[model samples]
Target: MNFILYAVPFFVVLIVLELIVDRWRGVSNYRLADAINSLSTGVLSTTTGLLTKGVGLVTYAFALKHLAVIELSAESAWVWVFAFVLYDLCYYWLHRMGHERNILWAAHSVHHQSEDYNLSTALRQTSTGFLLSWIFYLPMAVLGVPLLVFVSVAALNLLYQFWVHTRHIPKLGWFEWFFVTPSNHRAHHAQNALYMDRNYGGVFIVWDRLFGTYQEEDDNDPAIFGVTTPLASWNPLWANMQFYAQLWNDARRAESLWDKLRIWFMRTGWRPADVAAKYPMAKPDLSQFRKFEVPLDGRQQLYVALQFGVYVALGSYLMNLADSLPTAALVLGWGAVAFGLFAQGAALENRPWAFRLELLRLALNLPLVWLAPLAGLWPASAVAWVGLLSYSLFSVIGLYCCRNRITRLAS
Candidate 1:
């Protein structure tokens, strides 16, 4: 049923609510550029995963499809509860490993690159995590937990983790000892040393507390979020490529054959001996690092809130149209829209090139959407062409207005 797709409605609502409430502290890191950039990366990650889903379908059909392997125990609700608990336990391990192992970290680091955490942070999920994550749930499938229960609990496990990404909440007294609270998770999101790699639970802090991996959110030690290596550039493709490219360079520069092969699985930050001394590791000075604060005017939050809502609505409608029309419709029409959004984000970030690109989309929308969709001036689909033409016309005009403003500001 594509629950992830269905979840977009709730996501839209949450982002809009986040805006209307105007949460500066929570939305502190939220910026228009960050939102647009992270989302562009997110869209690319999702597109990449769709290419990977074929691999999943084959694995499920050939290897894991047999129904006989699953046995749902009918005797107790306690089993359902146990499945939920175990899922979090698995999640804790996977989350911990993602931080500890550089190979996995490449895929996982995309989520952490955002200097600011917000509703966009929630969407910043790694589409590539599907590679290893599904394995953790096999025990549930093996134990005969109904796929239905397994999926419901998995969804709940995921949904529960969403609210914890913010800076809004404070420490709950003993609640920290049990469930994963927002306070506990803020510590997880912090770039500070002591907080790094601690608090790995998805829904239950008890797993972390029980495992002795827990740390409290220190009011004294605030979070300086984002990776040690910056995602300073705004390109979405570059954001996904950043860590992997770093790893690739390290492997190439390694002094020995053993070092080259060992790099990926080594304790994530490890480097070859000569390289280490040359690039001698600076012990991270916590004293020099301070918590990140958003310098934006309060009204920019209003701009972010309004524009983000508009994008989500636009994305949602495009998706719905994809479903209503033929597969060709989705590939040709929806894909064009997504590509255009990415192109638009790239244009906005590149000051020298932005206005020209904006003008191009403004000019081409009718040719791209209308003439392209309705088979070009054939009388049969003239009405369909009109609807598309109208949308293209509005979009072109809008782009022209934005272009005019950019030119004014530059001069």
Candidate 2:
């Protein structure tokens, strides 16, 4: 069972609840643009996972089949408990290494790009983590933990970590010592010199405590969220690509072949001596750290919000149909989702190109609906066609209506 599928509705409810709580408590933890971008990257990551997850499964199966040192029965409760702990240990290292290595950070940095730390930030995950994350879990397969057991524990570990992303939760004295509570995880998310790269455990804080990576939440030094180098944009696609682009540019500028080759695997944020001297990167002043924001009229914000809601609906439908859809259909669906997110990101940023791209997206949906049934990609239903056409038409009309609002905001 895909536990995340069942958890989606709960995730949505909790996010909405958090927003309401933010209002009731007079604390500002959720920002509209930032939350939308976080969820957009999350949706993109899920869509990408439909294609990439097989790599992890296949590799794990291979390791189990060829290299098992001992056979373990999945029916035992003790085995489940042991596997759960072992998985977190592996996750700790995988997460720690994700922060330590340059190429790995390129993938992991998406989760940290959001300046606001809230429940929405929890969902902002990396689509590219499939590149190397599976390598960390091979030990479980070698120990002969059944695939089902491994998957179940992995889901549990992930679910356990979700609630720790919030700011509303304060430190729990005894509980904080054993588990990765919000306080500890918030410290992990901080860009502060004291907390950066600390607390890598997923569910248990013991690994961090034992390994000397744990840092307590300090009253004097409050947690400041986000990466040292700010993402500085609202584009979800760019959020994923930005770090890789930086690494690529640094590698291209390096004078030596060795520098170019090792730049990717070197410690996170390391630059070649020559590249550092000539093409120096400016560090943000910590005292003056500010969250990224853009001014927009009410209609522009509403339009983006409504469209993102539609994208979420579409994404849920795609995830439901993922296993049954043909590769071509999945590709088309993913392209549409990616384009929608890109357009939404652009619109949020008030980019001039957004309107044209959104217009193109609206126009393209007509043909997609008209031919979806012909290609047998969509179920042949009058209501489905009407729904698609209605959404497309309504979106175009909304964009047309919002033009003046966008112009005024831009002015």
Candidate 3:
């Protein structure tokens, strides 16, 4: 069972509640573009997970079959409890390595790209994490934890982390010492020197405390969210690929083959001496830091918001039907969704070409409405066709209206 799917409505509810709290407190923690960009990465991650999750599942299953020392029953309550805690311990190392190593950070940095830390940031996940993340939990499989237990505990651990991404909650007195909380987790998200790589635990704070990575949240030195190397664009596709692209370029530029091969495994931010000398990258001064922003008029904002809403609905539909859909349909659906998100991000960034991109996306959907069903995504129905056609028609009209605003902003 996909527990995250069932929890989507609750996540929406909590985000809305956080917005209300933001209003009541008269502090703005959420930006429309930043939040939308964060969610775009999340939606992309979920859609990508449909195709890639089998990597982890298959490998873990193979490990359990070949390497298990004992058979653990999923029916035992103690097994569930033990698996939950143990899964978090494995997560601690994975989370820590994701920060410490270049290759892992290339995948994990998606979650840290948001300049504003909010509930939406929690949803900003890595689409490529399945490639290596499964290795972290092989210990559980070898120790004989049932697959069902491992998956359930993993999901529960993730769900528990959603609420800790907020600034609204203060330090919970004694609870701060044991479990991961809003205060400590905020420190984890900070780019400040004091908080750079601290607080790596997912559920329990004890791992950090035990491993000497713990650092308390200080009132004097507040947290500044985002990475050392900022992801300035709102483009979801670029957000995922930015660091990897940097690494690839650095590798290509290095004079030594060993530097090329080992660059990926080196500590985060480490660069070859030759590459570092030729192409110097400067870290921003935190004291003079400013969040990335692109101005949009009211019409542009509404147009992007409406378009994003349509994709969110489409994304939810894709998630629900993904398992039953054929490979051709999944590929087509994934491509359309991915393109739609990129166009939305372009729109948010006020790119001059955004209007054409959106218009093209809408025009393509006119055929996709008919083609999607034929490709085995859904059964053909008049309602699906008409609903999609109407959506495209109105969206084209909206995109046409926003052309001037996008042009003015881009210029």
Candidate 4:
């Protein structure tokens, strides 16, 4: 079962509650564009996972079947408890390596690109993590943990992490020493020198403490969220591709063959000597740091928010029927969703072409609604057509109303 799917409503509620807390405290921890971009990456990740998750599941099943040394029963309570603990241990190393290695960081950096640390940041996950993340849990399969137990524990570990992304909660006295909490997890998200690469645990803070990786949240030196090399864009597609694009350019510029090959596996942020000397990248001074922002008028904001809502609703629908959908339908649905998110990001950035692209997307939806059923994207039903037509019509009206406000910003 997809536990995350069931938890979506709760996640939305808590995010709203967090917003309320933010207003009450007069702390601006969330920005509309940043939050939307964070969620855009998250929705993209979920949609992408539908096609990629088989990589991990297939490999784990293969390992469990051909290489298991013992058979563990899923029915035992002790097995569930033990698997949960052991999964955290495996996760610690995966999470650590994701920061320490360049190749892994290429995938993991998506989560850290958000300048603001909030509950939405927790949802900003790596879509490509399935490629290598499964290797960390092979031990569980070899040690005979049942597949059901492994999957359940993994989901539970992830769900437990959602609440820790907030600044509203303080250190919970003695509880801080054992399990992961908001305070310590905040340190993990920090880009500050003192907090960089610390607190890698998912559920238990014990792993970090035991492994000498733990660092207490220092009140004097507060946490600064986001990576040193800022994403600096609201585009969800660019957010995922930013690091890999950098690595690719660096690899192409390197003079030596060994430097080209080794660049990918080197420590995170390590560049070739030649590339470093010629194409220098400067790290921002944290003392003078400012969050990335693009101004949008009220009309534009409402239009973006309404359109984002539509995509979120569609994304949820895609997630629900992902398993049952045909490959062609899934790919088409994902492409449409991805394009919608890209357009929304462009709108947020106040790009000159954003308004036209959005108009095109809305116009295309009319034909897509009718054509989709014929292509096996959805069943031919009046309800689906009417629902989609109404959505497109309303969205077009909103876009039309926001035209002057949106276009003037780019001017």
Worst 10 residues of 1 by lDDT: 291-300
lDDT of each model, Cα atoms only?
Answer: 0.66, 0.91, 0.93, 0.93
Q: How far is candidate 4 from the true structure (C-alpha RMSD, Å)?
A: 1.4
**TM-score result, candidate 2:** 0.97
lDDT of 3 by residue, 1-411 (tens): 999999999999999999999999999999999999999999999988888888999899999999999889999999999899999999999999999999999999999999999999999998888989999999999989998898889999999999999999999999999999999999999999999999999999999999999999999999999999999999999999999999999999999999999999999999999999999999999999999999888898898888888778878988999888898887777888899999999989988787778788888987898788789987899998988899888887777777766568769
lDDT of 2 at 151: 91
- Pull out the clashing pairs in model 2: none
Once model 4 is optimally superposed onto the true structure by TM-score, how far is the C-alpha of residue 399 displaced, in angstroms? 1.3
Per-residue CA lDDT of candidate 4, range 113-202, in tens? 999999999999888888899999999999899999998999999999999999999999999999999999999999999999999999
Candidate 1 residue pairs in clash (backbone atoms < 3 Å): 71-144, 72-144
TM-score of each: 0.79, 0.97, 0.98, 0.97
Model 1, 199-285: lDDT tens per residue? 988888888888789999888888777777767755666677787887788888878999898888888788888667666646446
Question: What is the Å distance of residue 5 in model 2 from its true position?
Answer: 0.6
Q: Model 2 residue 199 lDDT?
A: 96
